[model samples]
Target chain A: MKPFTQHSGIAAALLVDNIDTDQIIPSREMKRVSKLGLGEGLFAGWRYVYDGAERAGENAEFVLNDPVFRNATILLGGANFGCGSSREHAVWALADFGIRAVIASSFGRIFRNNCARNGLLAVELAAEHVDRIAAQGAEPVDIDLEACRLTLGDGTTIDFDVPPADRDMLIRGLDYIDFALRYADDIDAFVTRDRRSRPWAHLRASES
Target chain B: MARTLFDKIWDRHVVRQLDDQSLLVYVDRVFLHERTGSVALTALEEEGRRVRNPQHVFATMDHILDTFPGRGDRTLVPGGEAFVKTMRRTANDVGIRLFDIHDGRHGITHLISAEQGITVPGLVVACPDSHTCTLGALGAIGWGIGTSDCEHVLATETLRAVKPGQLRVTFDGALGPGVTAKDMIVHLIARYTAAGARGFAMEYAGPAVEALDMDARFTLCNMAVEFSAFTGLIAPDATTLEYVRGRPYAPQGPDFEQAERNWSELRSDDDAEFDLEYRIDCSDIQPTVTWGTSPEHAVGIDGRVPDPETAGDHDAGRAMQLALDYMGLEPGQPLKTLPIDGAFIGSCTNARLSDLRAAAGILRGRRVARGVRAICTPGSQVVKQTAEAEGIDEVFLAAGFEWREPGCSLCFNAGGEGFAPEERVISSTNRNFRGRQGPRVRTHLASPAMVAAAAVSGAIADSREFAETGTNGQDAA
Candidate 1:
C-alpha cells in the first residue's frame, strides 16, 4: 500500500447514484487470479463500446473518457457510491486507474473499508459540497488527508470526514494485521475464556 | 441496561478496544470461495503468514466453476481455471478443509456454511462474498470483507472494526399466500432505498418474521447487503434450532443440548433500544420485481414503471431515466405481462431445497412458453441430490427448463454462460445490475416461484395468479 498524505490532481465527476462495484469493474472483467492489470478493465461496460464482444472503441460520452478529464486522479460521485458487492477489485481498479481519492455523500460500508485497507482515500462530504466540487469540471482539486479538507480549483475549501482509524491507516499505509497482532495476548485470553464457556463453538481438527 | 441481540454478540466477541470507536473483535469462522479466496490465500502465503486456526476456515469451489454436467477444471470464463487450481492448491497447503467440485459438500459459500453447521448462533463469521450476511439468518454476526481483511482473519482470527449502529425492522401481521420472504426484502429495499440501512446493522423481527421457516429466513436476510447494511440477523428460535440440530458440523448429544440452551438466550432484551426502528405490515407486501438496474427500482407485480418526471429531485429523476434507457422500459408500462426472453432460478439468494420445491410446484405438468429459455441450478450438491430424491428435477425438466449442476451459475456472468446480449431475463438472483447477466442484458430480480411463472407465461406475470388457480386450472398442490 502507498501512503497518501496529500494529492492534487484533476477530479472527474460521475454523479450517478448507486454506482455499484459491478459498474466499476464487471465480474466478467475480473478473470484473473492476481490483482494486477485491472486498470484496463475499469468501467469497461461504460468506458468502452463493444462491437459483438470486442472492444471496438472508447465511449467518449463517459466523463472519465472525455479528453479534458482523461487524467483525473480524484473522483466526485453521488450518494451511495460503490454500493454493491464486497469485491476489493473495484477499489484496486480505481487505484490502478490513477484515482487517489473519492468524494461522495456516502459510500457502501464494505467498500469504504476496502478503500482504507488499500490506501485509497474515501472522503464523505455533504451532498451539496460534492455538487460544488463536481461543478468545478475539469479543474484540479487538492486532498489533504491529515487536514481532512478538499480544495477546489477556485480556492473554495470544503471539509470532509474520514473516520479516524481510516485516516490513520491511509496516511501511514499501516497494515491492519500488524495493529491487530499487537494484541495477541488479548485475543488468546478471549479464546480461552470463550472456549470454556461455549465449547461447541470452537471446532477442533477431528470434529471438523 | 437492556441490550439488543447485536450488542450481545458484538460484546462477547470483543477482544480489546482499539479506540473509542473501534475494537479488536474475534472472528469464530471464516468461509472462502475460489473467486476471491485464491487471491487472499496467495497474498497470505507471499507474506509468510500461516492460518492461525485452519480448522475453523472453510473453502469451496463454487464461484467461477461451470455448472454443466461433467464439468471440470475447464471453464467458459477465460483464465477461470487458474482461480480453481490456485484455490485448491493453496487451501490444501494451508491445511484448511476444501470442498472441491467433486465433494458432496461443495456449494455456494453462504449456503454450505449453514448446511455444514459452520455458522451457529452468536458466532462471528467473515467471508469475501457480500452475501456472507446470509449466515446471519442463523443468529450469527456475519459480514463480507475485502481480500486484505480475509488475510488478516486467516493470520490472526481477529478484525479491527467499529461497532455499527443497530436498526430493528419489524414485519408485523401475517404474509399473504404466495408472498414469500423474497418479496418482504425486496419491498423493504424499494421503500427504503438501496442505501437506507447504511452504516447500520439490522435485525429482522416481529410476528411475520417469526412465522417464516428457516429457509425463508435465509432468503430474507440474504439481501441485507443490498440495503447497504453492515449485516442483518434474526433471533434464534425453535426453527433455527431444529434446522441446526444433527447437521454434520453441529454439536452432538450433550454438547448440542448445551448449545441450544445458549442459543435460547440470543434475543434482544424486551426493553432493548435501537438507533432506528421500522415496523412494516406484511400484508402490504406483494410479489415484488425489479423494473430497472438497481434492486431499489423494484415495484409490486401489479405496479407500473415509475415515470422519471415524478421520480423526485433532478438527480433522482436523471438516474431513473438512465435506468429506463438501459432496461428499455417505458415510464408508465405495467410490469405484468411484459415479455421476457429467459428465466433463471439459482444463486445463493433462493437456491435451497425449499426454493427448488416452490419452483417445482409451479412447473409440474406445465411447460415453458415457446421462445423462453428457462434454467435451474440448485444452490449446492446437497440441494441437488435432495431435490432429485424428491423427484423435483423431473418437474423442471418436463417444463423445458434446463436442470443443470449445482453452483452459482448465471448469477453474474462469471461462469461465461448467460442470456444473450440485450435479452430480458426474469431471475431469482439477488442483483439486477447492468450487464450482470451478460453484455447489454436486462435482469429483473424475483422469487423462485415468480421466475417459474414468468417462464410459463413467457412474460412477467404474478405468481399468485398461478397460486390461486393452478397452472393448468388444477390445484398446484
Candidate 2:
C-alpha cells in the first residue's frame, strides 16, 4: 500500500473489469480500520462458487478457484477497470491482493484517483501492450515505475509512457487535487490580484 | 455572448477566481453528510474557526444509515445509528439545519434538497456526494466535492472551481414502447463509453428530452456521473415549473408567480453556444442490459454479446474477454438467456413514487419468478408511506416482493441483505459496476419495469410482451 517511486513485486493479474468496491471488500469483511488482507475478497465470488444460478459453497467450482493466481501480483485488467460508487475499498483490495500495479487499457476516473491518492500504481497501457503482457500466460511479470516499463517473461521488456503530471503525482505519492490545493496560498494571492484588476468580475457568494 | 443560467448563477456566485483552475465560486446551498461534515467540523475545531453562516448548511444522515432491519438490533451495523446521532449533534453543534430519521425527511441528500425547494433555478449547490447532480434537473448546477472541499465550502460558502465544456444531447423520434429514461441514458452510456462526456457539462435537450416527464428527466440527469460528465443539466421549462409547484420548498402564491416567470426563460437561446453536441433517437433506444462490469459494457436487450473476433478495436477484444469472465457469458450469447436470481426496484436514481407506480403497474397480475427474491424499496419515508397508502405497495406485496423501508437498501449492499457472492441481480439502480449490490453479486442495471418483468419471468423477459399489454403509460403520450 506504499506509494513510492521504487518498488517491485510479483504480478498477479486480476484480469477483470468493473471490480466494484463492494466486491473488492464486502461491507461485512471491512470493520477494522487496519489495512488487513483484502486480497481474499478480490474475486471471492468467482474464485469460490458454483451452483444452479448461485455459486455453491463459498469455495465451490469457480474460475478463481483455478488456484494458479492465488497470490499473483500486477493485475492485467480490462477497460473501465473500476466503475461504480467512489468507494476506495476496490483499490485497497487490489493492492492487498498482492497487485503492485494494475495494467489496464483505461481506468475509471474516481477509481484511478482513489488508487493514486491511496497508493496504488495504476499503469495505463495501450490495449496491444496490455494484451501482450496478459498473453504471457500465468507467468510472473515485472513492473518498473521509475523506468516506466513492464517486463514479462522470456526476457522481453515493454516500456510504458505516462503523463508527466500523473507520473509526478505517483512518484511523489501525492493526491492530484490535494497537491493542487496545497498551493492554496499562491492561489489565494492570485485571486486577490485578479479581483483587484477586474472589479466587475467579483460576484457574491451563493445565497445565504 | 448572452449569459446562460449557469453563467448568470456563476457571475452571482464567484467570490473570486484562483489560479490552477480553482475559482472561489460561492455556494448557494451546502448539503453535508455524516463523514464530510465530521471532517469539516473537525478542521474548523482544530483551527478554532467558527462558521460564518450556519443557516445555509443542511445536513442529512443517509450516508451510513442502516437499511436492513435484521442486521441485529441496528447496532451491529457499522456507524449506522451513530451517524444519524452525529449528524443531528453536528448540525446543532455547528448551528446548521439537520434532517434526522424521525423528521420524516431522511433520504438521499439530493432528494431532500430538491423536495425542500432549497435547490432552485440559477443556484450553485455542492455536496460531498456525487448524486448532488440530481438537483440539476431543476436547472441548478449542483456538484459533489471532497471532504476537504466540504470544509472550505462550509467555512466560507465558496468552493474553488473550474467551468466545464458543454455538450448537448438532442434526441429525435418519440420514445419507443417500453423505453424509460433509464433505458435512454444506458443507451447513451453504452454508446459514449462513459468517458465520452468527460470535461464537459452535458445539456440534455431536444424533443426527446422535452417529452420526458420531470421524474424521467431526474433519472436522466442523475446518471450524468456514470458517463464521466462533471454535471448533467436540463433547462427549466414548464414541466420543471409544474414539478416544483406545491413542493414544500418551492415558492408559494405571489412568490410562485415571480418564480414561474423567471423559470420560464431558463432554456438556452436559439443562438446559445456549446462546445460539443450529439443526438440520440429515443425510439431507437431499447431496454438495455450490461454484459460486463462497466456501465459502458451494455447492449440493447435484443442485442447479443459481442464476438471478440469481430471486435475491430483492441479494447473491444478485452471487453469481450472481461464480459466472458465476469458475466459468464459466451461470445454471441443473448443476454435474455441468462437467469437472474434477484430483482431490485429502488435507488436514488429510480425509486420515486412514479417509479414505484410503474413497477407496480407492470407487476399487477404477475408473480415473481419462483426461487427469485425481489425487493422494492422507496426512496424516502414519504414515498414508501404514500405508495402503501395508494396501494402500490399492495401490488408489490401481491407480487411477493419484499416491501422495504426507505433507504438505499439492496442497491448499495449497506443493508447486509445484498447479493450473495456470485449471485446475479437485476436492478433498477444506476451503474452495474462489479459487486455494487453485494459481494460477487453481478448486477444488471435496468428500468423499474424491466426489473419487475425480470422478476416475473425469472429471467430477462421481453419487455415488449408486458409492454404490449397496454398497462403502462406507453400509449398515453
Scored by TM-score, the top model is 1
State fnat for each of the candidate structures. 0.74, 0.13
State, as a TM-score between 0 and 1, how close model 2 is to the true structure. 0.78
Candidate 2 error regions (>4 Å): A1-78, A88-107, A112-208, B2-12, B34-53, B68-85, B251-265, B467-477
Q: Residue B467 error for model 1, in Å? A: 4.1
lDDT of 2: 0.69
- Model 2 error, position B419 (Å): 3.2
Interface root-mean-square deviation, each candidate = 1.0, 6.5
Query: How well is each residue in A9-61 modelled by candidate 2, as lDDT tens digits?
Result: 44545554445444555555544323346666566545655464344566634
Provide the fnat value for model 1, as a fraction from 0 to 1.
0.74
For candidate 1, give the DockQ. Answer: 0.81
Write model 1 residue lDDT over B1-477, tens digit each, in one string.
999999998998999988878888899999999999999999999888889999899999887998999999889988999999999999999899999999998888899999999898889999998998898899999889988899999999988898999999999898877888899999999999888897699999998888788788888899999999999999999889988999998888888889888888899999999999988898899989999988999999999999989966555677788899999999899999999999999999999887888888888888999999999999988999998998999989999999988888999885778788889999999999998898899999999989999999999999987753221110122
Of candidate 1 chain A, the 10-residue stretch with the lowest lDDT total is A156-165
TM-score of 1: 0.98
